[model samples]
Target: MEMSELTALLTPEGLRLLDALGTVETTDAAARAVSTLRAAGHGPDLVAAVVGQAHLRAKARTKFGEFASRMLFTRAGLEQATRLSVAARHAGRLRTAGITHVADLGCGIGGDSLAFAGAGLRVTAVDADEITAALTAFNLAPFGDDATVLHSTAETADLTGIDAVWLDPARRTAGHSETRRVAATDYSPSLDWAFDLATRMPVGIKLGPGHDRDQLPAESEAQWVSVDGSVVELVLWSGALARPGVHRAAMVVRGGHTHELTAPADSEDAPVRELGAFLHEPDGAVIRARLIGDVARHLEAGMLDEHIAYLTSDAALTSPFVQSFRVREVLPVTPKAISAALRAGEIGTLEIKKRGVDIDPATFRKKLTLRGPNAATLILARVGSKRHAILADRVDAA
Candidate 1:
């Protein structure tokens, strides 16, 4: 079936069939939904979500599960995958911003919406797809009447007395391609329109982490958020929600690790401290937010390079964004030099880490035949034009 046909089938009939037969409490709903779509001879890829959604409804063993049902999942959601922790990261930002109420624009199956409610915030979840809206309503039912699920495009969604708006615009192009071809203006209307609507209320927009930095507003806080060390989504928070020039924030969700860094508004010099034999790389969010100065003070270290985000310290610093390693041996960045050291110590397996270097870790490892038991050393070398490798053991010191 064509894309338009698949979209049409998701209305009235498809929703009714799903509602009538999807109330079961098990993953078997997946098979049943697939059976229905197969019987209809619909595009298998098109209905794959229907199948997974069926399973999801049945898998609602927790309060959060009930909330996830209202969200709309795209092909990317399936491919890149969404988890409870990841969704909670976005919801946490809402809570941190002092938002007591939310308008969950494009609420896919209500995953993040549910999280907001679970975090004790009221929600108005909206979706253009009828089936998705129905699922959202059903999932949001446990939030009591405080949460409202609407069947409307983000453009027409009522925004009366809303505390905040969150939009995850569809980024995928037609034809199931991962790349987005729709111009910002082609988003049913335009991102500018969405931003205007948001300016009327507090708003948070979720975009691909690879989104163009040039297009972001001057006053917005563009945050590149990562959960468990992996960068997930780039978030745009308007001044309506948080004051402008709020240096971007990098949040590491797991372990509840957070580091706030801020640069001078006038681009003043970042105070450099002494290099204490160890360097730490701040998380992307911290670097983007220009919070390196604060991070340096937090770590009690100075900049190894005036502009680099790396922090150097001798005293063991316990920051989540920075890793601590003890330099076992500092050697030149050459195959022969590295090989000699590795063999002398009988270092067998090498964990190669390089920065500002062109040497491939795999190629370097293969050439060295890195073999040795027990401890290891770091090799510092310029891959092309700079010296930037540090061989170290994962020690307690920073």
Candidate 2:
């Protein structure tokens, strides 16, 4: 957005019009709303800003919930902004660690700052982008002076009196609508600088979940978090923020419930055993944290294959770290044979899950002629050197 457009949008008149418009659910509705506002004497810039904000606010609801209505966002900032629930977890960790004041470096739209303030911590939120810093200031307005948004690069931010540091470096090119990923070396303030700062003070560094584990600082505690079912981010905690005896951790958040597993070091993989009646699939966070073997050990399970992550056991036990399934039948791996077997079993509404295989679930589903009254999950995976298809029923966690 241009400076002129932003200046206009921050005005009382523009804000009133935007609030009056509320939310524009569809493009057709937005077009009609734009025409109505224009006919009512609103200028073109005001109309455009309000319309754009309406769409962004609607999209922000998934991340900020009701707070999205009161928030202003740039497309790229909103996309990179941490979800309110996830940010709250981060804030909770800081609060529990006795961190009262924090320096939020590269605070995008003040998502983490909002959470920190809400958790009763004084926050100094900094962002290199002027527009983003302005938006963050507006979003954090309710906190008064407790939340301060600064328009400055993280590398230049003065952290003299800050009790803790939270850095979310920009890992992508700057664009509101389109952005491309950049390397960690290209990150704003750079990972090297961030790590150096961590050595001097308690720090929480947020990075992509796929960040190289080999590059992580040995003294920091690395935690991988998954929201719902997708692995979202990897957080490295340094100094006092790093938990004792917790070098690796996986936190799985699903439907408001959180489950965490921590280990001092990577666990060894369980031995490969013959296929059992039950199959278990570890959550993505666990896999990313390399804690799958821990989950397998907890269930007294063994790997389906030496190299694959799939676990099997004779017991029908269930745990939060893994999704368990009860095996019903083992079928041939070929499409024709699998189709005949499924047809013979009168199966329909198939859920295809695969790992260690190159088959696209959508394309493979199209090849199968499924027509039956029954429904089941089909697991396609490699068992050592051979591919096997297992029909199973999902076992819900108790």
Candidate 3:
């Protein structure tokens, strides 16, 4: 959004209109709301800003929950904003480390800064973009003097007395939408500068989960986090912010429950064994953290393949780190043979899961001629270079 539009949005009349408009869910509804506001003599700029914000607030519910309603967001800021729950965890870590003051460099929309303030830490939230900084200031207003928003680059921000630093470097293009990923070396403030700052003070850096592991600093504690089955981001903690004796961690947040596995170093891969009665799929966080072997050891399981993350065990074992499935039967990897097996098993609906293969699940689903009275999950994987289709039933955690 333009600075003029933002200035107008902060005005008394604009605030009143935005408060009255509530949330506009659908595009049709937003269009109608915009038309009504225009008919009421509002200018196109004001109408457009309020209507766009209404839709953004609605979408922000997934990340910020109720707090989103009172906040303004830039399209790019909201997309990159950390989920409140996840931010809360970051805040807890800082609090636990005895950090009283934090400098949130490149604080997008003040999401993490808000968490830091709420955790009772004095926060200096800085964003280089004028509009984003203004929006952050608005979002953090409720905290009064506890939080301060600044419009400046991370490299230029003053960090003299800040107890710790939280850096979220701009990893994508400048646009609000249609943004493409930028290389790590090209990150705003640069990874080099960020890492240097980390050594001088306790620091936490948030990066994409798929970031090249080889480029990561070995001295930092790296944690991979997954929320509701989707791997989100990798966080690097340095100095006092890094947990004691924990160099690598996988945090899984599912159904409001949080679980973590930590190790000092990468765990060895479990031995590959024949298919057992049960198949286990490690959480994405665990897989990304390279701690799948640790999870396999906990479940008394072995890897299905040396390279694949799938695990199997003879006994019915349960763990928060892995989803257990009861293997019913093994079918031939060929589509025709798999279709015949499913038909004979009376499986009408199928959930196809594949790893270490190139087949698209959607296309493969279309090829299957399923007709029956049951539902089953089909796991297509390679065992010692040989492909096999395993039918299994999901075992829900009790």
Candidate 4:
């Protein structure tokens, strides 16, 4: 939003209107609201701002939950903001470290700052983007002086007496509705500066889970977090924030359950063996943290392929770190042969998963005409030097 548009929306009349409008979940509802507001003689800027925020609030629910209702957001800000649950976890870490005041550098939409203040820590939330800073101030307005929102670059923000720091450097070009990835060298606050600050005090830096593991600092603890199977972020912790005897960690959160796997160093790969009664797919965070070996050992499983992440074992075991599947039978590798086998079983619903294979699951699914009431999972994997097609059933842990 433009500065002038934001100026019109910060007033009492505008926020009340936004609250009254609620969320516009559909394009038709959005158009109706815009027309009604325009008919009521509201200025174009105020109408646009309220309508846009209403739309954003609807979209923000997935990340911010109910709190999104009272918060203002830009499209890009909402996209980059950390999920509330994850932010709260970060806040707990700082609190456990005995940090009283923390500086959140490049605080996009104040996600971490909100968590910090809510966890009873004083926060200095700084952002280089003027509009994002203003929205953050509004989001954290409830905390009053406990949360200080600043419209300044992280490099220029005064640290003063802060005990801990959180850095979320911009990895994309500045934008509102659309953004593209930029080279990490162009990141605001620079990795060099952020890493340097970590040496003096506890610091946490958030990066994409797929970030180059080789480029990570040797002195920090890297934690890969996955929510509901998707690997979300890789956080590097330094100083007291870094746990002792832990250089690599994987935090998997599914629904209300949370599990963590940590190791002092990269784990060795489990020995490869032939397919057994059950197959296991390590969670994305486990794969990213290179801790699959630990999970495999826990389940008494071995790698199905020397290079692939899939695991297999004769024992019927499962854990939060892996999605377990019961191997039904080995099927023919060709799509036509697979289709014939699927049709013979009257399987209508199929979940196709592929690894170390060149086939597109979607296109291959279309090739098979499913018509029965049965449902099954199809795993296409490369075992040793051979490609194998296996029918499997998802194991529901008891």
- The predictions' CA RMSDs to the true structure, in order, are 6.0, 1.3, 1.4, 1.1
Q: In model 4, which range of ten residues has the least summed lDDT?
A: 175-184
TM-score of each: 0.72, 0.97, 0.97, 0.98
lDDT of 2 by residue, 1-398 (tens): 66676888999998998898898888888899889989999888888889989988999999999999999998899999999999999999999999999999999898999999999999999999888889899999999999988999999998999999999989999866689999888998899999999999999999999999999999999999999889989999998899999999999998899999999988888889999999999999999888888899899999999888889999878898888999988988788988987898899889999999888999999989798899889999988788889999899875
Global Cα lDDT for candidate 3: 0.91
Give the candidate number with the greatest TM-score.
Answer: 4
Off by over 4 Å in 4: none
**Residue-level error in angstroms, candidate 3, position 94:** 0.6
Query: Distance (Å) between predicted and true CA of 155, model 3?
Result: 0.8
lDDT of each: 0.63, 0.92, 0.91, 0.92
Task: Give the Å shift of residue 331 in candidate 1.
Answer: 1.8
Regions of candidate 1 where Cα sits further than 4 Å from its true position: 1-74, 78-83, 86-100, 130-135, 174-189, 243-245, 256-276, 306-308, 375-384, 395-398
Question: Model 3, residue 103: what's the lDDT?
Answer: 96
**Model 2 segments more than 4 A misplaced:** none
lDDT of model 1, residue 240: 60
- lDDT, candidate 1, equals 0.63
Per-residue lDDT of 351-392 in model 3, one digit per residue for the tens? 999998888889989888799889999999878878888999
By lDDT rank, best first, the candidates go 4, 2, 3, 1
Error of 3 at 99 (Å): 0.9
Candidate 2 yields a Cα-based lDDT of 0.92
Segments of candidate 3 deviating more than 4 angstroms: none
